[model samples]
Target: MEITDLTPAELRVWRAFPLNEGVDLRESADDDPADGASWGPGRTVRAEVLRALLLDGPTTGGRVPGLKLTGARVTGRLDLMYGTVDPAMRLRSCHFEKPPNLYGAQVRALVLSDSVLPGLTAGTLRVGIVLRMTGCRVTGPVRLAGAQLSGALFLDGAVLGVPGARSGRPPGPEREDSGERPEPALQLNHATVGTDVWAVGLTAHGRVRMDGATVGGLVNLDDAELHDPDGLALEAETLSVGTDLRAARLRARGMVNLSGATIPRRLVLSSARLSTPAGQALRASVSTIGELWLRGTAPVQGAVNLRGAQLDLLEAAPEVWPERVRIDGLTYRRLSPHLPAERRLPLLEREETGHLPYAYEQLATAYRAAGDEVGARTVQLAKLRRHRRTLPPYARLWGYVQDVTVGYGFRPMRAAGWLLVLLLTGTLAFARERPRPLKADEAPDFNPVFYTLDLLLPIIGFGQEAAFAPRGVHQWLAYLLIVTGWILATTTAAGVTRALSRQ
Candidate 1:
């Protein structure tokens, strides 16, 4: 390749290489690299040549402190560890010979759009503005541990891969011998982004970790493809996102762990796909979010654990719910309008050992607040029945009695209905053959209705039974009436007490 064959854009970078000043590669004011940025292989920029230029102080003339080496093929690793580069590095549409080592480097804004690198070791890298990378390809892992970005960390439409990609490696990509989980394809462990961490249309072939990272804006991964098969694909534990954590249309191969994450806004996973056979597909245990929407999304093969999560609402279809999602401690105020308690209660029936009673209690409370007392009682009854299975034999029997008699104290009217049936049966049975008067001087005749009432009402007894004792079949009938009264009275009291306490 000769210099004369270089394009205008290539020639500009060649001419500006010696100045060490940050160069803007945009040829025209209306130019867009995302559309496509063309590059030529006419010249190759060595690592030492660029390093010398970057290490030197500013010239006597007024010049920007940043370094820009766009549209050039560089040979050798760019090591800027512990070095202070006064200006931003906008290396767009460039190819690196080796990974750039910027461990603990300080710079202004950092942009590496439309470039190719072997890997990146940017641990503790501090950027004043943004650390943005878009439309780039990296063969190895990209680490950003302890990094602090004043602006967003954009890796949109980038293709990231893991070098060795062993079955079960340790964290941070450096420990391949430990045999733990593989390091994230794009690691941001404890990195704080002032704005967003936009990776829309990203294709990563390893774990994506943002543990303890704080994003002031959204963490959008819409249409992103991530895979780690036997391990976690996305681990954002303890992450704090100020706005939405949108991952619509995301296709993740393994578990997506967001345990203890805090998102003040919503977590939109509409149409997203996540699958993990070994364990939970999505673990948001103890995470706090405004809302979670999984509308029309792909079903997860494994459990989606949301234990201890606090959210404003949950939007998910019943049929599309995961096989075993643990919502034991999920504190959500509302379900989607399409998913009333009648439809959504089944999803809470996860946790193979049986769901926690509080889970059902919370859902019933939500239904109750929505002016659906019947629905609330329905959920409450289910909770009681499910919880009964976990109790001792005696308690379970009691729960059964309560359920059949008064719907576990939810149907006090059932108890009253039984009382009315007993009263009617006794009155009608005794009316056929009234008890004969034992005393001839008895002034009042035996009233069948009053006599039946006296036998049925256990709280009060009348002298009718003592005055005229029944014979044979009638004697047995009287015994039956007395037992019926006792059963009704006891159950009615229990039901009334339960109802009053519920209120």
Candidate 2:
């Protein structure tokens, strides 16, 4: 770090560092080092020079020192591993020959916006303030595992990893089979950010790992395109966010897993296009979210798994529902749009796995809590109908009878209506032809109403059934009445018992 080794461009940046003034070395705004790397020594600053300027004190008489350089080409690695840098560093519109090795370094603030670098290796780095990398193009992986940031992490408009030639997609199958396991484009595993992580308009070619990361504020991924066709596009399992995770218009080529996460506020995935054909597109199983908004126009291409999730409110549109869903243990207190049970029942029916009774039960509970007893019954009826499909032939036939007779015990009034119709028919039929007495001396008077009542009520004998005996069709009519009476009594008792047991 001798003074004689400073190039003209480096000397200019060094002199400007004392006054905290940013030195712009570009001749024009279009003078990009990413195009052909033709920047001469006049705009090229060695990484060692910049590193020394950040760590060392200012030269002669000067103001408070800070390294603020723009539109310069940084050559060689800015190896600041395990170093403590107090000044704020801003290297906007710059190009780096190699990734800055800041592993285990503690910095005040770092801004590399609109910069082009091979990559960054800042694992376990500590930042006192914000780390802004907006509008940068990073070719290699940006590993920030276990890093702790006291402020927000701004990555909006940044392009990370080697993006595909076609619309920033991931590498093709041939490139994937090159026998090398690709690293994540943006790795924040186990990182703790005090504030938000704004990643809007980000295009990441590989996986974005934020597993076990804790964000104090919201994490906005709006308009972000993540591509990892061979694996997960974004894996944030067990991620704990204090506020919301807004990802509207996000296009992920692989699975977006948030399993075991806890988002206290909202998790908005509106208009997100997630595709992992024949696999799960979104898995937020066992998570706890306050409000989950899936209401949007885009169609999810794969199954959505919310098994064991607990949500305060689930807001989803009909068009956004995928073909297959796993809601085994999902429990939501409310469903959005205030739709009726009939309309929302289709969501519970979309489970391709075995019939989940818990989902139906949860929906019914939600409806009942909203003071919609009829809607709750409808959901319960639908649950029985779905369960009936899994029964044997005879059981299914019996299920149909139960459904028609009493709505599987959810409609007690239907049983009453059937009883009334049967009672009236019996009264009319027997009154037309009275039966002869079985024993003339002991027989009671022939009373059609009492005789029909005796036939209908199995346990109650009105003494008229014993006294009467009908001939020919009259006998057949009596037999029909007797069987009808018993069947109605049995069904009514069963339905009533079921209804009471549920309560």
In order, the Cα lDDT scores of the candidates are 0.77, 0.86
Q: What TM-score does candidate 1 reach?
A: 0.86
**Residues 166-242, candidate 1, lDDT per residue (tens digit)?**
42332343443345555567788899889999999999988888889998999999999888855688989999998
Question: Which portions of model 1 miss their true places by more than 4 Å?
Answer: 1-41, 57-69, 162-177, 338-342, 353-355, 391-395, 460-468
Give the alpha carbon lDDT tens digit for every residue of 15-87 in model 2.
8888888799888988765852677888889999988988894845646778888899899999998899988
Choose the strongest candidate by lDDT.
2
> Whole-model lDDT, candidate 1?
0.77
Worst 10 residues of 2 by lDDT: 167-176
Q: Candidate 2 — which residues are off by over 4 angstroms?
A: 59-62, 165-180, 390-397, 437-450, 459-463
Candidate 2 residue pairs in backbone clash: none
Backbone clashes for every candidate come to 2, 0
The Cα error of candidate 2 at residue 11, in Å, is 0.8
